[model samples]
Target: MSASPHPLHELDPAPAPSVLALVPAPAPVPAVPVVPANRAPRANTPLMRKEHRDNIALFRYQVIRGAADPSLSTRQRGPLVRALALVDHPWPYGGTRRFSRESLDRWIKAWHRDGFDGLKPDERATAPGTDPSILLLAESLKREKPNRTTAQVKRIITETLGQAPSETTLLRHFRAKNISTGARPVATGRFETVASNEIWVGDALHGPRIGGRKTYLFAFLDDHSRMVTTARWAWAEDAIRLSAVLRPALETHGIPEVLYLDNGAAMSDKSLARTCAKLGIKLVHSAPYRPQGRGKIERFFNTVTSQFLGEITVTDTPMLPGTAPEAGSQIGSLEELNTLFTAWVNMVYHHQQHSSTGQTPLTRWEASWEHRTPVRKPLETIRQAFLWSDTRKVSKTGTVSLHSNSYEVDPLLAGTSIELVYDPFDLDGEITVNNNQGIPAGTAKPVDIGRHVHTKVINAVKDNDTATNINTGINYLDLVATRHRQSLSGAPISFADLHDHTTPKNQTQPAVSEEEQP
Candidate 1:
């Protein structure tokens, strides 16, 4: 097999000198006629050797002067002699870069060790040199700052040892320990604590589109506490997007030992994973579609849909006041609904006792959170949750068809598709609808047939042919009552009452059609 690619330089070497062939001996030429005011010099006067001699003379003069000076030292003069070797140019050192002493020392060391191979970069070590101590330092740096580059590590090495190790050396050291320079696997699938606040699960939930629009909800719930840490609305579920919601959860309540979530695009981002690694908090993701593993967060989403989004009415407006339109409102277009939800979460939900825990999530958190501590997810980890997906058109009536039900989107989405992405289990989970230019269409409203009202009841009555479609069971209540209770108060009312009320007080002879008369 072919040899592996060389690692980055441990020592940068200088360019080798060019070897030139010897010239044959030549007869000395007589001096050429000098050019005079009255006569032109010889037609083909050869001046190349003369110019070369002149340059050599000038360089020698400068070197002698430089060496003779009291301030100049041998260490500085040696490089000047080397510079004098190229004397044809006005400046002998022109256009050439020189290696520092340390750099040259490294180059010489590599050359002696590997011969011609030294001319090429060294093969990277599988581990950081033979020095276990330096490897330990590198490991610590990696743990402390996973995103740090080789150059950064080198700087750190310099700080500790007063010298930088070759990048290749560091790479080899990491490789020996099976540490990859890029994309080290994130630790996942490890078991976590069962108690709330012991591990907090966070996720995104997709909600129905309103007025032909969609939206997303982000939520965090404690594992032991079972209390909702926080919930927010967003158009995307990017890592950065989710971190904004997660930060308050971590800061307000101490840190959670473990943060659990699904292997969504946002959570899988390398930047986020690296952040978690540095924080020493284990980041766990549920196996694809095995949501049962994260039942708590799943239950949270179910409640969010049935109780929160179901009750709200989204209205499109500037996402941030003063800016052009952003996301549509959730909870309700009414600020009152938003305030109510916020209040309920902080005051009621956090304090409410869980059926499983038999204590409020906040109380449990207060007991154990200070010491175990929750991790502060970095901002980079929060940025991965965002992705772009295409939007769809809404009909003139402001309804967009999704799955089976028609949801209300913003008026602006009329006959246009937009882009969107979100977590399906977050507090504000839903495909947030956006306008043509990607602004929130407005909060999505679910299209529903409300409780049976007067009109529906009247319509049902009109559709029924009472007399012809009457069931004989209509009289069963009268028979049951006679067989059971004797009191009028407890007796069952039946069709018998209809007949008794309709009967005339006095009997009268009635003529009817032959078919009707019996």
Candidate 2:
């Protein structure tokens, strides 16, 4: 074959001018100037005044300064933020100065990003038609019904105006105007009962460590007399410990008409509620997070921390009333701590004149009984009031299980739910079974004992006895094996001989054939 005039690669012809002219070129991209990573954007923009920017930045810095410390560990930051959150600060724009932990965290992050300028408030452009009139209407709607939420107000505005600003915008405006959906301020004044034993304010204080385990002081104060009705230190802060403190108070001081307590798990336990109900004492729990009415008990705790706990020292012999502890004395055990506290409370605190009451707690408590008698309940009735109960459905086998311990109930109670009322600390003791209607059904007898007490009770006991004595060296399984060997010691090995050996002494032995003999 002849070679082509052009090589195979150069054989194609050029395109027409019309085709070349039809193709368009790509558009050019705008150049964005590179800003250094370390450089922060200017916060004092032309629109904002210098004074405004400074004020905003200062407020942010003050709110987050403590939490933003570089040396603070992760664990320390949380407590710092929480403490700051509790405080009220001066706002630059003039309003409620409280900042939430989340807000503080965000401010800290902003400070890290831009040093000082990042802390300045972001100036967001207001959406169109968000005029003062619409805000006024929203405010009116909120004021019309204090219960109406921000979102509900927004919905009402949206329906009326065909378009409404965002909920955040409405909230900001509402907040600035001092209109809030939260609890309204109520007129409050100091209150006291006309006589003692009218109301008892109860609370618990977290006490110092005794023998390496934390202790809690459960106390009740007479609201009228400011007397410490009952107080005791316990290893646990559960309903059982609370009962131990309260039962004695009721017995010694007589029952109060009302029991005022905070909404703690130990305070709000159903057992306590049941106890109060049975005793006809009104149980009232303070609103959650509101401690306005609990100042007396709190003051009592402060006195305890300062006056009593400061002087305690572990000693083989009890310290005299006015004597200070020797420097070398050890930290006391729980029993010693309680002993010292009881002595201090009786001799010192009860006799000291209270600033608010103007009389010693003991004197006030006694004086209140001059004209009126305190309501008293029988010891047996009070004991029955404090017992804890659990509801269980009896199984088909006429048994009920409590804390994994099985107990046999009345056969009639089978296939029915019944209440198991017993001492939480003594689960192995008598458990009174009551029917669904709360009538006495029968007693619950132990069938299979797995646990002798509730799990919490076991923990409390361990907390109380921090230094458990060494176990006595005894192997139960080995003892059982030895008993088995002793039982088999003189018995014949052959099955027939074993049966004959076990026969009564007066009964004639079975005659064995020679073939069958071993």
Candidate 3:
């Protein structure tokens, strides 16, 4: 009764069904492939960079993919687009920064096409070694005279290429690539003087071709300051050119105590030595086979080669004369080249820290400010000293002959030996006549000549025409007299024939030649 104890557990509720037993076994878990340990881990190498770049590139891919999806509305796209520029991402080598969405798009394409390898930076296709002129010169130098001394090879390369690699860069390349001609190393032991203007070393460096002609740079380097005194590109490496560069340098940088140079013919000329002596500069020459003495200037020239000329020489842009050049190429003439070099020297080189002196050349040169002692010679005297000179005796008529032209000298200079100082191009501008004691006698003027010495060769044609006019009054009077006489003598006077057919009756006209008559 009492429901039999409410079924007293009703024989226990039937056991609940096992949910785990009823559920189907999960699909076998996918095995995560383990990377092997022995494979060299790319640490700080380009390869390691490639992996990080790949992940970043994948992210970019996903971003772009979401952008193309119609499901991503403007609300979603706006922030995503803004985040590309604002959000910082790890860059491979240059450092971490935000990239342009466009750049991200490019990387994504790179990775999609080439996989991880595409993410690596591409090697530069244009290196100094790959330059056609440099390579040809290097190979030619090695082949022509195998086993040339390194120094000899260096000189050859410098002369041929108009610039040569630094000794260290060249030698490293030579050893690594077997391009060295077996040769002895350079001998060391050099003399160095202190103070910026105390000593200056001068040397010549071949320069890149301008148009069809090659150039040679005559330069002087301040030993103490490492400052380039003056540099000019010349077609000839002679005393004239050297003096041309030296005079300006002396004027600007002050006279050096000693001028050191190699045994080049131009450097050893008596004219340079005389000039140096006159300026109180002790001219010193390095012993044969001793370039170490001029190491400063040589290194300076090397810097010009590597820093200035190298950048210009690597250009592949063709520069045919008369043809317009591509942008960034100012290499049209020697003047332009020097203009560029001057700007570079005054603005860039003078301001930069030198590797050896740890000071800018201008700063170093200016540092010992009180040490400067410029020459006191009059500018005219300095000018005369630098210019080309010759002696000629004035004729009795106060005239002198030079370069096959007659010049009128001072009346007092007549029948006396005098020195002629003048520029070769300025014959008409006249020249200064100095006595044997170097005192100015007077100025000489070139005699007038109707003919020009040299006519310009131009591509255009010009007209050289002449005409003559004579008064017709006398002829007209004679005609009138004849006509009156003919009337008085009863001869016919045809008034119709008295005037020109092309002119009015009262108008005066020129008499026509017999050949002009119809």
Among the numbered candidates, top lDDT falls to 2
What ranges in model 1 sit over 4 Å off?
Answer: 1-197, 210-212, 315-340, 369-518
TM-scores of the candidates in the order shown: 0.32, 0.50, 0.45
Supply the global lDDT for candidate 2: 0.66
- When 1 and 3 are scored with TM-score, the better candidate is 3
Error of 3 at 3 (Å): 98
Q: Write the per-residue lDDT of candidate 2 for residues 384-489, one digit (tens) a residue.
A: 7877889999999999999989999999988999999887667788899999998999899998888877775565544433332322222211222233332221
The window of 10 residues in a row where model 2 has the poorest summed lDDT is: 507-516
List candidate 2 stretches off by more than 4 Å. Answer: 1-189, 313-330, 462-518
Ranking by lDDT: 2, 3, 1
Candidate order by TM-score, decreasing, is: 2, 3, 1
lDDT of each: 0.46, 0.66, 0.54
Report the Cα lDDT for candidate 3: 0.54
- Output the worst ten-in-a-row residue range by lDDT, candidate 3: 509-518
After TM-score superposition, the amount by which residue 11's alpha carbon in candidate 1 deviates from its true location, in angstroms, is 99
Error of 2 at 480 (Å): 56
